[model samples]
Target: MSQGKRTSQGKRTSRGIRTSQGIRGGLLRRHRDFRLLWCGETAGKFGASVSGVAMPLVAVSTLHASTFEVGLLSAAAWAPWLIIGLPVGAWVDRLRRRPIMLTAAAVSLVLFAGVPVAARFDRLSIELLLAVALLTGTAAVFFQTAYSAYLPSILEPADQPEGNAKLHGSASAAQIAGLGSGGLIAQMAGAVNGMFAHASTFLVSLLCLAGIRHREPRAAMTGPRSSSLVGEVREGLRLIAHDRWLRTLTLFGAASNLALMGYQSIQVVFLVRTVGLAPGPVGALIAATGAGGVAGAFAARRVAVRIGTARATLLFELGLSVFALLIPLTVGGAGVLLFVVGGFCVSAGVVAGNIIKASFQQRYCPPELLGRLTASTAFLSYGTIPLGALLGGALGTALGIRTAMAITTAGIPLAALILFFSPIRRCRDLPTSRRPTPDSTRPPAPDGEPALPRP
Candidate 1:
C-alpha cells in the first residue's frame, strides 16, 4: 500500500511539472487572441521603425533638407500628441477599442502609401512629407490610446507582466529588422520608394486586428450623456495630479522624453555629417544599437521580481542612462562604436522602464479610468517630444550637433531625479491600490475581481 501511494504521488508530480513547463513556454504559444494582438502590434512597430530611418534619409539625401528642417520633420510626427491626445483618450473610453485601432491602421495604410505615390509622380516635397507625417501621427494617437485600454480587457492582472514583456520584446526585435532594412532599401533603391514597405506593414497589422477572436464589450458609461468632453479631460488630468505614483511617473516620463527625443531628433544628422557615415551604415548602426531593447524586455520581469518594480525602474531609467554621454564622442571607423554603446544602454533602460510602468498602470488604475489615465499621462509625456525635437534642431544650429548631443544625453539621467525626489523612493513594490478611508463609499468590484480603489 505504501509503494502504491508513492507511485501515484510521483505520477501526479510528473504531470504537474509538464503542465508548468507548457505554461512557461509563453502566451504566444497558448493564447490565440493575445498572439494575434502581439503579431499586429509588432508589425506596426516594425513599419514605424522603417519609416523613422527612411523619412529622414529622404529629406537629407533627396530633398537636401537642412538640420532644422530634419528636426521639424521629426517634430511633426509627434505634434498630434499635443493637439488631439486629450480628447482621444475620452473618446477611446467611450467606444470599442478594437474598431478604433482598426480604423487608425487603415488610415495609416492609406497615408503611408500616398507618400510613395506622390514620389512616383514627381510631386514629393518637404511640405508633403510633413503633412503625411502629421496625419499619420494623428492616426497613431488614436490607435495607441485604444490599444493600451484594450490590452487590460483581455489580460488578467497576473498575466499582464508577461504580456507586456512579450509585446515589448517582439516590438524591439521587429524594430531591429525594420531599421536595418530601411537603410538597405534606401541604399539599393531610392529613399522615396521606401514608403511602400511602411505602407505594407499596416496591411499586416489590419488583417491581424480583424482576425482577433475575442471581442471587447462596449465601454461602461461612467457619467451622463451630456457630460462635456472638457470635463472628462479635466478628470484625467486631476487623477494624474492627485495620485502621487501617477504624478511622479508622468513627470519623469515627460522630462525623460524631452531629453530622449532631443537627441534622437538630430542623431541622423550627427551620424551622417559629424561622424561622416554613409546612409546605409547609419541605419545599420542604429539598428544594431536597438538590440538592447530586446535584452531589456527579456530581463524586465526577472529584474522586477528580484529587486522590486520601484527599484528596477530607478536602476533602468537612471543607472543605465548615464552612458548617454558617450554618444557625442563618436567619430569614424572604430570610434562609431561609442555611439552604439551609448544608444544601446539608453534603449535598454527606456524599454525596461516602459514595461514596468505599463504593468503598474494597468494593475493600479481603475478600469474605467484607464483610458483617461493613459491619455493624460501620454499627453504630458509625448507633448514634450515635439518641443524636444525643435530644441535639438535649434541647439544643433546654434551650438553644433555634437554639443547638442552632449546636452540632450546628459538630461536622460538627470530626468530620473524626479523619481528619486518623489514618493516612489520610499516604496519597495509599487502600491497595487489606493487605501480607502473608513467611511469610503466606493462599491466593490463585481465578478470576484479586485476592489476598485479611489483615484
Candidate 2:
C-alpha cells in the first residue's frame, strides 16, 4: 500500500492543518474525500434545520393543527429511526454509499417539494405532510449510516476529531442560522413556499454531495451474506451488545434521548403556562438552545482532548443532570433563566457525546459495519423517543406539566450513573493504529478483537 496516502472525497484542507495519525506517524491530515463528504453532509443538515422550523410552522399555521397535532408532526419524523434503523443499516452496508447518499438527498428534496406543490394546487393535507416527514426521516437513516461508514477512510485517527468537528459544527451552526431564517422566510413566502425552501436547500445539498468521488467496496462488508436479512441485522445487534462499553454508552444515550423528547414535548406548554411567556419568547427560547449548541461544538475538541473524550462526556452529562432539575422551578420568570442554562448544558453534553461516541466507534469499526452498527446504535437508543414523548404528554396531562417534566428530568441522573460505572469513563489513553490502509471499512482494533474497555 502507498505509505500514509491520505485520500477521501474532495475534502479541501488547509496545509497548516496537521496532526499525527497513530498509524502512519505522519502529520495530522484530512483527506480530500472526507472533506467533501463532511461538506456535503453539513450542507444537507442545514436544509434539515430549515425543515425543522418550516415543517412545524406549516402544521401549526397552515393546517391549524392543535398543539397535539404539532407534536405529532415532530414525532412522525423521529419515529422511523426507531422503526427502520437496523434493517436500513444492514442494507446500507450492502450498497455503495455515494449512490445511496445521493438518492437519499434527491428523495428527501422531492418530499419537501411536494408540500409546496400540493398546497399550490390546494391539495395539501396534514396526512400528506406527515407522510413526507416520515419518508425523509427514513432516508436520513440511510444517508447518515453511509456517511458514518465512509468517513474513516480519508484521514489518520488523529484527524477524525477535527474532521468531525467541522461536520458537526456546520450542523450546530445551521440549527442557529437555518431555524431563525426559515421562520423569517416562511413568514414572507407563506407556509407552502417555506416548505419549498427546505427542498431548495436539499437540492443544493445534493449538488455538493455529488461533487465528491471515492471508490467503495463492490461487495457487502460482511464476509458472506446471511440467508436472511433479519439474521444479518441480528449480527449487528449482537456485536453492539457484546461490546460492554458501547452497550453502556448506548443505554445512556437512549435514556438521555428519551428524557430530551419528554422535556421537549411539554416545553412550550411550560413556557406559556408556567413561565408566563408568550409565543414569541417561546420561539426565542428554542432558538437560544441552538446558540448554546454552536458554542459547545466549537469547544468540543479542547475539552475532549484534555479530559479524554470519555471523561469529558461523563463530566458533561453530570452538568446536564444538575441543570435539568431546574426545569420545574418556575418562579417569577425564573423558568426561562433556568431553561436557558439547562439548554446550554444539554447542548454541550449532546455535542460532546457525539464527538466521543463517533470517535470511539470509528476507531473500532470497519468501513462495511458502519451502516449496521450506526443503525443498531441509533435504533436502540433513539427508538424510545416517541414512547417517551407520549408518556410525557400523558403524565403532563395527569400530573400537571411541571410535575411530569420533573419526572422526565430524572433520566439525566440515570445516564450519568451509567457513564460513571462504565469502563469507558476511565479509558483515557487514545487507541493506536500501526497500519496505513486507507480503507474506511476496517477490521477490529485491539488486534482483531473488540477494544472492549475495562469496567
Candidate 3:
C-alpha cells in the first residue's frame, strides 16, 4: 500500500476508536473533564439555591423587612447584569473562562461565609445582606458569561446537546435538593448556619473546577492588536441587533423573565401571608417546581425532534407557561396544589427552552463571538429582572399581593406571543446562520435543518 493511503487509514482507525469509546460509556462515566465540570456547576447551583432561600428568610424573619424591601434585595442581586454585562462580555472573550469561574467561586465563598460571622457578632442587617447578595451576584454574571462560552470548547458539536441537557438536569436537581434542605437547616440550625452551608458548596465547586484539564484555545491574535473595548462590545450588540433570530429570542427572553420575576418577587410573601404556609413547606413547594425542570431537561431533545426545534420552543414557552395564571387561583388546603401545578409547567417549559436555546447558540454562533453573544443576550434577558421585582413589589403593596400576582402571572403567556408573531413561528427549525456580511470571511454557521430563505 502507498504511504499516503496507510497514513489516512491509521487516522480513520483512531477516529473510529474514539467514537466507539464515547458510545460505550455515557458522558459522566466516560468523559473525565465533563464530569468534573458538571460536578462543579451542580455544586455551585446548590449553593446558590440555598442562598436564595436563606437570604429572603433572613430578611423577612430576622430583620422584618417589608415586601418592597424584600423585592429590592432580590433586584439588587441581578441589577449588575444590566449595569456591567456588556463590558464583562468583552473581558470574558479576552480571557480564559475557567480562571474566571474559579475566581468568582472563591469570592462567593468568602462573602457568604462572612454572613454567619456577622450574625454571631450582632452586626447583621438587611443592608449588609443586600450588599453580600449584590457582590455575589456580580461575580455570578462573569462566571455565567464565561461558562456559557466555555462549554462549546470542551465538548464537540455532536455532544453539545447532551452536555447541555445533563448540565441543566443536574442544576435543577441541585436546586431541588438545596431548597428542600435549606428550610430545614434554617429551622434547625438557624438561617445563619444555612448561609454557612451555602458557603461550603462553593468550596466544593472551587475544588472540582480546580481539577478540570481542558484549556481554552488562546484568544485569537489575528485582529488589530489594539482593539478598543467599546468596539468589541459594540460588535456583540450589532450582531444581535442585525440577526433576526437572536433579536426575536432576546426580546422573548426579556419579556418572559420580566413576567417570571414579577410574580416570583412576591411569591414567598403571597404564600406566607395568604396561603398561611410555614417556611419549611414553602421551601418544599418551591422545590417541587424543580421536579418539572428535571423532566423538561430529559425531554428537550425528544420534543424538539418530534415538533421541530422552533415549534417546540413556542410550545414550551406559550402552551405550558399559560398555566402560570393558575398560581393566583391557589388557596390554603387543597388549593396550594394549583400553585404547584402551575409553577411546575412554567418551570418545565423554561428549563427545556433554555437547554434548546443554549445548545442552539453554541452551534450557531462563531466561536470567537460566543462570550459577547451570551452577555448581550443575558443583558437584555436579565436586565428586566430588577424592573419586574420593583413592579411586583409596588403592585403587591398597592393592590394587594393576590391581585399583583394575578396580573403578573397573566403576562407569561402574553410574552410568548412575541415569538409566535416573529419569524420563529412559520419556520420549522431555527436558522443556523445570519446573512453573511459582504466583508466577512467567516464560514456559514453549523447547518441544522436546512436554512429557510430569509424572512
Question: Among these predicted structures, which one has the highest lDDT?
Answer: 1
lDDT accuracy of residue 280 in candidate 3: 87
Please tell me which model should have the higher lDDT, number 2 or number 3. Answer: 3
**Candidate 1 residue-wise lDDT at 194:** 82
lDDT of 1 by residue, 126-195 (tens): 9999999999999999999999988977765556778999999999999999999899898899787788
How many backbone clashes are present in model 3? 0
Model 2 alpha-carbon miss at residue 205, Å: 1.0
Candidate topping TM-score: 3
In order of lDDT, best first, we have 1, 3, 2
Q: What lDDT would candidate 1 get against the real structure?
A: 0.85
Q: List lDDT for all candidates, in order.
A: 0.85, 0.69, 0.83
* Comparing 1 and 3 on TM-score, the stronger one: 3
- Candidate 2 worst ten-residue window by lDDT: 9-18
* CA lDDT for candidate 3: 0.83
Q: Local error of candidate 1 at 181, Å?
A: 0.7
Q: How well does candidate 1 score on lDDT at residue 226?
A: 26
